[model samples]
Target: MEATETVLCSLLAVDLTDYCYRVCSRCQRVLPSDNNGLASSSFCNFCKSKEPKLLYRILMSIATDTSVKTVICFDRAATVLFGCSADEFFHFTKLNPLAASMVNQVFDGEMLRMTLTRPHNRNAQHMRVTSIVPLRSGFQPAIVTLTHICTKNASLGNCSTTNHTLRKGRAVVLDDPNEETQTALVADPNQEKSQKKGMILPFKPLTMTFHNVNYYVDMPKEMRSQGVPETRLQLLSNVSGVFSPGVLTALVGSSGAGKTTLMDVLAGRKTGGYTEGDIRISGHPNEQTFARISGYVEQNDIHSPQVTVEESLWFSASLCLPKEISKEQKKVGMDEFYLIWLRYG
Candidate 1:
């Protein structure tokens, strides 16, 4: 009965009550706990080490159109689902008590691609989730989701004070009860003004210049057999261009004129061809850093037809922007992008 299967399913529910377990660090066996539910200091007969480590083990329900299954996931697959290591997530949950609920909220109804393994025994009760991958491009990590939840909760006047002790045995205070209300009462004029003017992206203006750019690919064997002496077929030759900031640049050419090839070389998207050129970004030689500042869309790129334009923009902003940015700011950026598209697209 040993079989493995892959399926596309929606995560219906998660149970976090017993989401983790303590294991012997050396032998990786389940460790016993005392009456208070704390790890015991008893010696391990397997490896004779007393150290214990926590590992994530999650129980979740996944469903397709008709059938549903209960799956057990170990640490590696659990990390992929939560987007953080087990120890880190444990510490985060301790610091923010709302994190567990927030995680469930974020993952509820999320689509996932999962690999499931059936046990060799015919009477096994649950399938094992060997791997997990989020199908949504805008999937947020557990920490990010928790932070957003905490911020939203605070804004809604649901803050509380808690005292915590650090690993160094120092006492720390978190979230004064009056802090949120006091901050809400006082508004920053500069922030308001900036909001009215719309958010500015954190990017400096850059210009790209290329001179004598040429591209070549290996000549096919069929052509070489036909008595062609050259071993390489040149696609572009001595092409020069400059694209400045805040300018519209268009490459116009008939089919087979190498317009797409030239753009691919400039954008560093060519995978199998040899390129020769002096391509510079703002007077500096173009390197891997160019990928961080530039974007290229292929002619055959496709998106989900079921998703609307606004939904696509929001998803892109959520995925591409740094986690430090607030959800409100992301919404604002999405609105701005929608307006630009309406005007130019």
Candidate 2:
């Protein structure tokens, strides 16, 4: 039977073998690998792109008290458990054989609230884990815990396969035989500090003004039959407002007030209503660009239930940020917003 469920369960075991798969960055389809386990082509057959980047698709078999389920955790949920992206996790495991075992130890018997979905197809084997939240407070991700263990073992002369060093707040992996070193910086603490210092993304701020705004909808048949002679019912009349940048504006009104109607007209969000008004942005008449610059939040908003907050921010940054900004800058901007949200929200 197809079903979706939320359960409070403890992780009994986790299988780390074959934990990740490679997919085309453009189309997100599985890419075939060669004999050396490298992507066969730089071009994606599905998207027809010449320079196709690769991303990691993380999968795991997790056992709970009820049953053992193989689930596709995807990127966001997997990142929460690993404290790093799937690509970084794969690289760490390749450099050190004990990394996977250490991760298992870190996650074993952890309490979690999981949203699981079963496919409608009876032949499908794996259930999809839409979301994962650690039930315990002060939860540490696997990578951080493993890094600590590895560092401790190295200092005590117990680690033999690889050497660990901390350089510039990053974990550096040194191969013993050739003395070759690979450094992976999970996150920059200094950058986070700077974000906490109130760094904001650059944008051209504008002021919005609406004068003598009016909104109306067609009078219902029942209302017309009740001896109402008007052809249209007015929801808002003579609503005037000026909203400036960097200012918090409140629309204080009780039930049946025209606050929502005025906002809908100003934001060009009223779908079936007729609006008559002079709505200007920065003293200019409202244009198509107004929709791009302004946003309206409805009383009730809908979002994908499966997406985590981090994932939502990433998606919004990738899609809504200016195209001129580089990807790295966009990432930094997204992080700054995330920090602000956590602090105030």
Candidate 3:
């Protein structure tokens, strides 16, 4: 007999989850070999014996296909990406809104694409994520390729993570999607919009401000503390923008014009520690209060070897999202179509 790889959609869970549904009328009653096989099962001797293995297989398949980075059993994963680590991040953060959303689609026959900025340790940093839901449920990824969208090196990693220089073609890794989620998967009507185009951000501002920002060109403390003058810290520059939300704003200039400094300031990097100006987020331009909603993607990222495009997006989605959203809502949000353009920090 030929090796059997059950077409996932054609199979239904023996469990009483929504993953099992009636077959289309055109199909036969006994689990159709194609699109019409969802049904509840009353296990006999064979079913009872095979249940464990079958469920395991399904879960493994889900894990393999989910393709996200930094699967958080808790909120620690979120902190790791934000430079806040577990203890601090968990205290005051919500679930990563974007990653949580894509998890459903990945199981609902959606394939995602991820563009990571400043990738390292196979993590997607400052990422642009999108998804493509298949017309039929439980299909393979429609389009998959992970790229980059960034301005430049945005921040410094902790000592443990910095010594390692990033090499190209490293594979990103993440926890497998849960069986429970896959069992309850549902396709989104808006998936078409997200899949055909670029990534979606739940809340991004139109005009951003940078005030009292400072910058300097010096090697990290470890490398330059000796003999290197601390005074090399020059006031790189100060800048502010009236960038319209959902529109691209480009900062173009020569090598030494402080473009990196400007991108960092707008992103709330080292500069966030110093400045005060109102960044108008959507219509809620409190400048002072709502600025944390911004995203800062760098030029490189942590992409694992053999990680599919969709997996990369999932990783970014998880890290970028806010905690307030529910799992189902996240699925719908990430499924919408978008347009992504690259930035140079």
Candidate 4:
């Protein structure tokens, strides 16, 4: 409401709506959708409450009501939410001024803030996308939806503050309107005297640089050392290649030559250095589907040797699969062998 004054529309402070953000069609304002209703000048009851919180609640409700099914968020978290770093996404796909607008518009045109990192025991990277999208039902009304997507490709860097705020489901705001988290922030010092004004930095993707086991432990200390040259030993040396669902791929290598990194990537673990290429769980790739379709199996045994192999695998399966089932699942298949025992290496 504090932008330029014009008689074309009345700008008012919007606090009642939980999904307090919207992209104006004509002017493309990232302000609250007070009256962004398709119809003239009227904001309905649904638009008032059916925003980010309500949409997520409804989606969860539907997922539970159907008990037999699963759900997902519908788009890649990286491109959808981190388009603010259109410069970086340029490394993946080129973005022109118009294409940038198109990409951002479909993604609700709000600034994208995202982060990607590898898990400790897994190979794949975790990318967190935080942006607001609009959910609609024909011409009825439109409400904002808060979306978060984690994906493959690479570990994200530059998203510490954002990740902290998102983990708690809140946005970080500064007390001093003119103070900056860093000098890069554009704050009008003169305006601090005339009331206060804060500039909004569109969200960007934070990268996580993952490292291999041998070098990963010493990375933090190494990065802190002065006068050391930056090297590609981490970024270009990814051993955890990408994988597709239902496709049979093999990660063949010497015992210590990084086969496990390949396996970890497919499992979606958060490794801090190497880049993860891509991940697709089931046919529908979205934020929500990740929780269900994505499951991992470590090679080590979690059961005692006294227990039979069938009993052990069954126990592991029960952790993810249904607890109640017919006796047909009782069957067992043994295919255990160590790398050194085989002659492939």
Error of 3 at 14 (Å): 59
Highest-scoring model, lDDT: 1
Q: What are the candidates' C-alpha RMSDs? A: 22.3, 24.2, 27.8, 22.8
| lDDT assessment of candidate 1 | 0.66
Alpha carbon lDDT of each predicted model:
0.66, 0.63, 0.32, 0.29
Error (Å) of candidate 4 at residue 243 is 4.4
Candidate 1 lDDT, 1-345, residue by residue in tens:
568989876665566655566788787666766888676765676788878876666678665433555788777786777656655666666666665544554454566789998777744568888888887665644555455445545555553223322111111112334454211110234543544464333334455667778899999999999999999999999887666444576889766899988988888889897999777664457997688878888886356889997777777677667889999989887778778888999
Pairs in steric clash, model 2: none
Q: Which ten residues in a row have the lowest lDDT in candidate 2?
A: 170-179
* Candidate 3, superposed: residue stretches over 4 Å from native: 1-205, 211-232, 271-292, 301-345
User: Candidate 1: where is the Cα deviation over 4 Å?
Assistant: 22-52, 87-91, 94-97, 121-124, 155-345
- lDDT (10s digit) by residue, model 2, range 1-345: 568988654453345544454667766655666988777877667887665555555666443433444576666777887777767776777665555555554454466788988778754467767689987665756666566545544654543333333233322222232234322222345744654555344344455666678899999999999999999999998777666444576889765797777877787777897888777664457876678876777876456879997787777677666789998998888789878988999
TM-score of 2: 0.38
Per candidate, the number of residue pairs that clash is 0, 0, 39, 28
The CA root-mean-square deviation of candidate 1, after full C-alpha superposition on the true structure, stands at: 22.3
TM-score of each model, in listed order: 0.38, 0.38, 0.23, 0.21
The residue pairs in collision within model 1 are none
Candidate 4 lDDT over 17-136, as tens digits, reads 112123333332222343543323222333343222112100100101101121111123323333222223332222122222222222221221122222343322221122223222
How far out, in Å, is residue 101 in model 1? 3.2
- Candidate 4 Cα misplacement greater than 4 A, ranges: 1-228, 231-247, 274-289, 301-345
